[model samples]
Target chain A: MEASGEVRRFAHQQWPYEPNYKRVNGWQMHYVDEGVGNPVVLLHGNPAWGFLYRKFVKPLSAAGRRVIVPDMVGFGLSEKPVREQAHTLDGHIANLTGLLRQLDLRNATMVCHDWGGPTGLGFALSNSDRVRALVIMSTWAWPLPPAEFHKRIFPWRMMHAPLVGPYLLGHHNALAGRGMYLSVVDRKKFRAEAQSVYEGILPDPGSRLLTWTWPRWIPLDESARGLARFEWLERELRKSKFPTLLVWGREDEVFDHATFATRFKELLPHAEGPELVTGRHFLQEDSGEEIAGKINRFLDRIDGKQS
Target chain B: MTEIHVIENYTPEGKRRAFVLAEDRVGHYPEFREFFVRQFSLGANRLERPGYVRASSGMIYALVFIGRSGEPFPDGIEIYALPDALEPLNDSDVDADLWALLRWMIAGVGGEWRVEQLDATGRLYQLSVAANA
Candidate 1:
């Protein structure tokens, strides 16, 4: 995790792009592929990284779009696996399926959020014909129903207590300091130069052990432990017909688009929107340019280039 | 002797709701910490304290009904009592002796039970059972 030159001059003064490491499973995976066309890919979650899509990677890479975003091995400027079962969820979907098979990101367009909705729908339910579209936000694929206020939540049961989830996310980092200011709803857009590049790439406690093992791998039943891969990603995203959209945040306070946005519009019913804006739960720090102008009008109405 | 499932509902503007799902226990379940400290007195909300932490596998209550000054309990209701299972955190509202003390603590801890009700526009309702030992 060596980005110092004052963290590469504060990531070139807050993301100027042009950094792109690979080497997935041995760690060193930072990313930001930048402009071209047809590929989007931004996936971030938990105390954030991939610099939380640095404002949708330069306006969707100046509108021509080829954005890609990465940084997930242990978060931004990658490489921090001081073993906590090597931060599993099958080791972050095998480091984002080996960085989309070492960058052969075909078709694409998979922007996600919050544990990037089961690691970007478990890599689009195992590369469903190279996932052409799907925006989704807030997050949840399935299996989570048993709430009493998640055991009277205080540090979300101290991050699911296994020795106080490694002493408050590995010795007092407290989820990048107080769970990133209580998961933003604009706390003045988390200023101080984005909390100094998010508490300067995990400054201590053995690099916050993947934000203390990501809320104890939140699956919450069907006898957890990645609930059969999110119940096979809710039965293949309910027969995925692609072109999904769902962009929530109607006051999230932890994924409450009034209780999972009508179950993600009843499981992607010709998935278009659960849109409902005015944010919280880092709705990309309260609407990152109206979520990149609704992902450029959902990729120009799914390539019919909008009538 | 393991089985606990209590579910009840109402919300589409009506208000009143409930949830308690823990079944066939496995690793940690002291009868949901004695049915959530006897239906949420939780030792008088932890002796009027509101924010807490114990964790080794139990106690992390924070039912703060609002009071932010150096912040921690931002909204309200959060519990994570473990022995087998009992997890609650932010969705709010529950307490009508929480469904008769989760059916008298699953018949005073005597095995297999299921009671359901989830339909605030997401069906999966009623499935009662308690008489077993």
Candidate 2:
């Protein structure tokens, strides 16, 4: 926790974005704001901060879209609360809501992945008027059964285990350390420098709780926390006519194409694709350039229709 | 004369669960006192009252303190420790000496044991195995 500033400095070295801060809730929330035009807001999931979308910022901004990526409260340069209770599905949505309202973002294109799926969709489903399009990747907004890999690995049980969970996750930084490494298809791309940036950002046991909470938050049934909101998301998704697109990490075992991406298509029936590209769970790391191209083209199509 | 008392209970599933009180304080035993002080600096002013929590799988592991026990801590399992200020809990410092202490304490109870903050003013010190040992 003491070395957090040094870690943030190191993170900025690789992340290479001018940091912006907004006082959302009590914590100083960190975000990246670049270019000018209709806003394209990007949200990252657990164990990932705005750094995940660093590759997209330049291209998307050059394409004349404002890029805004917020490091969800618990991750990135955002001020982290030591208590796990501070991180909840509803709490995150509220924080995102606070940021958007303060920034006065409207007619935005929302890009979501991993836990970003729920956090971004949660905001979008409720604030339909403010959003224009959505690009969903390797994430879920429904309360489906645990995915196959999740079932096989049983991350839920381990993450919640008393000493074991805290030791491996909160204490040992296993999720951000080894888990992030395994999240990609090409292990070569996940170099030690990048890994340190992820691990360095969370320097202590308490700082790692956010990563630990995301897996534990996976909804198992209707009684799960944030179930009602996700239910609302599932029920409301079809009704929304916003231009939608689906993309996936071809090799993702965690939220693989068959289960997650396919389900996304089923819900957003008219959505553009279940476009499978290179990478695994953290697909953005593996195929950011290729995916950015896909996103640019998708936005162009959306712009054509609007014009 | 460690003056440690072992409290036993059954989980809802009827698994045998146990915890220890070291003279109604943490570090009543010399070994625990030495390890916590060396690793966590149990004398630090910013932190207070370190304890552990029990999980569903019947494992006791996380380090908790007064006014800060958060999620993944299941209900009903009581923790007993001498309220003592320790060094900021870090992942790297948790493995060797702390793990050795945890393994030693759990060995007495047959699998799992928890230490908790019972009151704001009371200090729960080093726990000793009164029953098994």
| Cα displacement (Å) at residue A105, model 1 | 16
Judged by lDDT against the true structure, how good is candidate 1?
Answer: 0.61
Minimal lDDT window, size 10, model 2 chain A: A1-10
lDDT tens digits by residue: candidate 1, A241-305: 78888888888767777677678788888888788787777778667877888888889777874
Tens digit of per-residue lDDT, candidate 1, span B1-133: 1222322221122212222221111112334444444444444563353322222222222222332354232212333222213334332222222223333433443332222211110111111211121
Cα misplacement distance, residue A205 of candidate 1 (Å): 12
The segments of candidate 2 whose C-alpha lies over 4 angstroms from its true place after superposition are: A1-13, A152-156, B1-133
Q: What DockQ do you compute for every candidate structure?
A: 0.03, 0.05
Interface RMSD of 1: 13.7
lDDT of 2 by residue, A181-211 (tens): 8788777768644677778878887777777
